[model samples]
Target: MQPGKILVAEQDGAFVIKLVGEVRLTLCTTMDDFFDDMLTSKGFASVVIDLVDATNIDSTTLGLLAKLAIKAKQRFSYVPVILSTNPDITRVLDSMGFDRVFCIRQEPVVDDEDLNELPVLPDSEDAVRAKVLEAHRVLMGMNDSNRAKFRELVTLLEGQCY
Candidate 1:
């Protein structure tokens, strides 16, 4: 699998984020920061996550995406869109209950010319751990299946923080 890189663009209050290659925990901090900024930005209207080129996306990244969708719906009253063409990735998203939080589409995003790669932000081990834990907690809150799936991992992560 190719290494993952995140690309982003914003126009007229619509934000587009394209994930390329194998997206994993290494990019979680960057993803989290971008989500925070995007959610708070003035004129924020909608967010569309493009995953057509994403070869793989780990649970951490999926959790962060879930976090984005949940926050957007709560604050903006609209579900975010997720563009994903790969069936395997789509299956993963379905299994994780993403369909509840995001409007999943098996199509490509239009007008991607202005998209720019987002730089990976460096984070300390503790900060990364906390983000990972928080992400899983959000995922766990989504559904019973997800709660069961991530409970043990969340417990382990929480224990390690002490």
Candidate 2:
């Protein structure tokens, strides 16, 4: 499968992220960097995640989305919205406890025509590892099921930390 791409844009104090194709581990660093920059910027008010074109998304990507929701609420006092038209993807999101942090809508996102693809940043081994570990940790915090599912991998990643 082809790697996923993230398209991003800012509109009237809100940021939008559109995920396309297969979203997996390789996009974690880029997502993490974008999250950092978006969350830190002044006057940032809200965020929307458009998953209409996403064919598949992995656990790491789910974790990063979770992180986005959590941070958005904590930092900006707004719950991030996730627009997904695919039932399968919506099912996956529901199963992963996304409803707790995001406003999951079974509809298309608005004003997506102006978004531009975020360039995939070159990855460093340490940066990728850190992003992966952080994403999984955020996932584990969602519920007991997630914690149980990711505990071993978290331990393994922790061990690899120097």
Candidate 3:
């Protein structure tokens, strides 16, 4: 699989993030930091996530996407839109209870204007572990199915932190 890459853009108060290639646990810190910055820096009226080019996305990346939608709802009363053309990805989203948090779409994002690549940040092991734990915790909170799905993995990840 190709390495993962994250791209982002802003239009007015609306922000767009595109996921390319394979997104995995290696990007946990970068994903976490982007979410933190996006939430705290300035409020967004809309957040769009494009996953059309994403070959594969692991649980950690999915969790961060969930976190974005949940935070957007809590902070701005908005449900972020996810643009995913791949049927497999849509199935994964459905399984993860993403329907409860994000507005999932199968079409490509109409507006590709102003999109820029987001730099991947270097992370320490501790930071990556923390982000992974927090992301999974958020996913587990979304519903019982997710909770059960990730419980064992979360337990193992938690053990690594200590």
Find the candidate with the highest lDDT and give its number: 1
Error (Å) of candidate 2 at residue 16 is: 1.3
- Top model by TM-score, which number? 1
Tens digit of per-residue lDDT, candidate 2, span 85-158: 99999998998899999999988975678999998888988878888898899999999889999999999998
Superposition TM-score, candidate 2 onto the true structure:
0.94
Give candidate 1's error at residue 41 in angstroms. Answer: 0.3
Question: Candidates 1 and 3: which is better by lDDT?
Answer: 1
Ranking by TM-score: 1, 2, 3
Give every collision pair in model 1: none
lDDT string, candidate 1, 1-162, tens digits = 799999999988998999999998999999999999999999999999999999999888989999999999999998999999999999999999999999999999766788999999999998999999999999999899999999999999999887
Candidate 1 lDDT trough over 10 residues, lowest sum: 107-116
Question: Could you tell me the TM-score of candidate 1?
Answer: 0.97
Return the lDDT, model 2, position 142.
Answer: 96
Q: Model 2, residue 124: what's the lDDT?
A: 84
Q: lDDT at 85 for candidate 3?
A: 91
Per-model TM-score, in order, reads 0.97, 0.94, 0.94
Model 3 bad stretches (over 4 Å) = 111-113
Alpha-carbon RMSD to native, per candidate: 0.9, 1.2, 1.4
Better of 1 and 2 by lDDT: 1
